[model samples]
Target: MKRTLVFGDIHGGLKALIQLLEKIDYSKNDRFIFLGDYVDGWSESKQLIDFLIELSQKQECIFIKGNHDAWCQEWLENDVVNDIWFLHGGKSTIESYKGIDSSHKEKHLEFFNEMKDYFVDENNNLFIHAGFSSMHGPEKEHYKTNYSWDRTLWEMALTMDERIQKDSLLYPKRLLLFNEIYIGHTPTLHYNVEIPMQGCNVWNIDTGAGFYGKLSCIDIESKEFWQSDVLQTLYPNEKGRNK
Candidate 1:
């Protein structure tokens, strides 16, 4: 019996991720959709990716690209490390693999290269790191990268009056076409919640594990969720959101 599970941004909280997995009692038959930002923040970005790569071999997995991952890809492909990346936790990622072997580095790059901008399951449930164009679907000519960087989709969900019927012409057609949308770029903690949040048909699962919150994983079908300890506790030596 394979189960579908979606994880929020990791941001190098390897210990948090591990604890969350254990809490869920993960099995090989599970299908996982990781909502990106696996690297950055904590100090084990490299190790976290390595574990994810190995996990893929034992279970079904879909890795969605996040904004942080885009920065990582840019750095890996062109050796371009922007100040924004470091400011947003790239410094720790870089330090994590300071003396890592080139071969291992290549493997991580390959994993990052293969990540998807967004994924729509057979049931039309959309999974993306960030949001997408509300006016158009992924088929639009806009930069596809926006699938992992856009926020309007979530913003609309956050602001809309749920009681009012969603009019296709008045709402994002993209959202209308899906049964549900799952996003991770915006931490739910910002909304004062430490758990996956549902607004309209969109689910915000990034519970700020990258900062002072916890890592969350939820079952798409059952809505059951598991979370790690406060990330700051996982990395007592590091300044998480405080940084």
Candidate 2:
């Protein structure tokens, strides 16, 4: 059977991302869902985008847009970097493209423009870069950007008591709308775990590849996973967002 693999925020850690793919021995039969924030934090934002563009030609790939990606998109379109974006990780991305030609810049911008806010599979599995509004389902048609920026969904799962997992009524209906929900953005490392985390039906796979944690990928069907070494180990010269 074909496998579906999901990846968390890369934050521009090209080396780690490449290593993680190698560790998984990714095959063309695999369908990959990337949870976004592909650029920023690390120095290889440009290279990361290039890699993904190439990978998409080789396999099925789904790209979700993260807030960082939004900021990057804005910078690409208007050439005005948001102050907060610069503070967060945009500075490195800008530096990475210093002296780079415009044609490649356009390619990266186009990739960012085409990213989706979320993806729902035939099995009703929701894959997103961040949480979605629990009050409004993903199908709701207003301020759709919230699908990639909301944190309440994950926050609810993170705070939910383990004993309540089986209580259908206790869980929010929006979360129950899907068989499984995978998200990035909030790093599992903050929860003191470097591995993918499961809370209720939600899985937080952002193992903090932007910081001290590793980049993570997991098979949605088998729950098997692979992770790269620490971000510091892969990009020893760069401080990334950990600074």
Candidate 3:
């Protein structure tokens, strides 16, 4: 049977990632998909990226760009944007490369730039970094831009109801017939009461691994879910209290 394992946000948790991979029992025939946010929050961003690069060279691996990743690439491309980049989880990412040299930094940026916006299988299983705009339903054409940083379309779609009209609608040929999509970016209900519907059909696998939640992954063909234990606390609990 053809198997594709889709991993959720890493957030620089190399140990957790390694544990999850062990559980999956990776094989030569199976394909692996990373849904982005490979850095930040945890302390192993550089190691995780290096491991991903090595894996990509050996087996089939799909990478999607996340918001944090976008910032990393921007900071690496130009030094002028350092302030803005550091504000968005770039601090931890930079710290991950403390001992590395200029050559390694260039390679890291190259890898980040090469990541794809989305990955689709023969069965039409769509894997995107972040959730798609509800305005476009699950169509591919609506996902032309990098969703990692684009919020205009998403913000508009969030306010509207969920409905795909045949007429006066933009639907991509690739997703017009697909049954499901797998994505990251938006956290699940575990983090917030009003879970964003923009991630709905997007099969959110993020699960806020680096926050007050657990890491998640799923088998596209089986719809079977797997999650790692909550790594640590990220914020105060409800009622304005700390845990």
Report the lDDT tens digits of candidate 2 across residue range 154-204: 888878877766556786777678899999999988889989998778999
Q: C-alpha displacement of 116 in model 1, angstroms?
A: 0.6
Q: Could you arrange the candidates by lDDT from highest to lowest?
A: 2, 1, 3
Clash totals for all models, in order?
0, 0, 0
Which candidate's lDDT is highest? Answer: 2
Better of 1 and 2 by lDDT: 2
lDDT of 1: 0.87
Q: Clash pairs of candidate 3?
A: none
lDDT of 1 by residue, 1-243 (tens): 778899999999999988988899878888899999998899999899999999999889999999898898788778788898988899988888888787987998999999998898988898989887746677662778777788888888888866667764566566687899999999887789989999888999999988899999999999999999999998999986456
lDDT of 3: 0.67
Lowest summed lDDT across 10 adjacent residues in model 1 is found at 132-141
Local distance difference test scores for all models: 0.87, 0.89, 0.67
Worst 10 residues of 2 by lDDT: 134-143
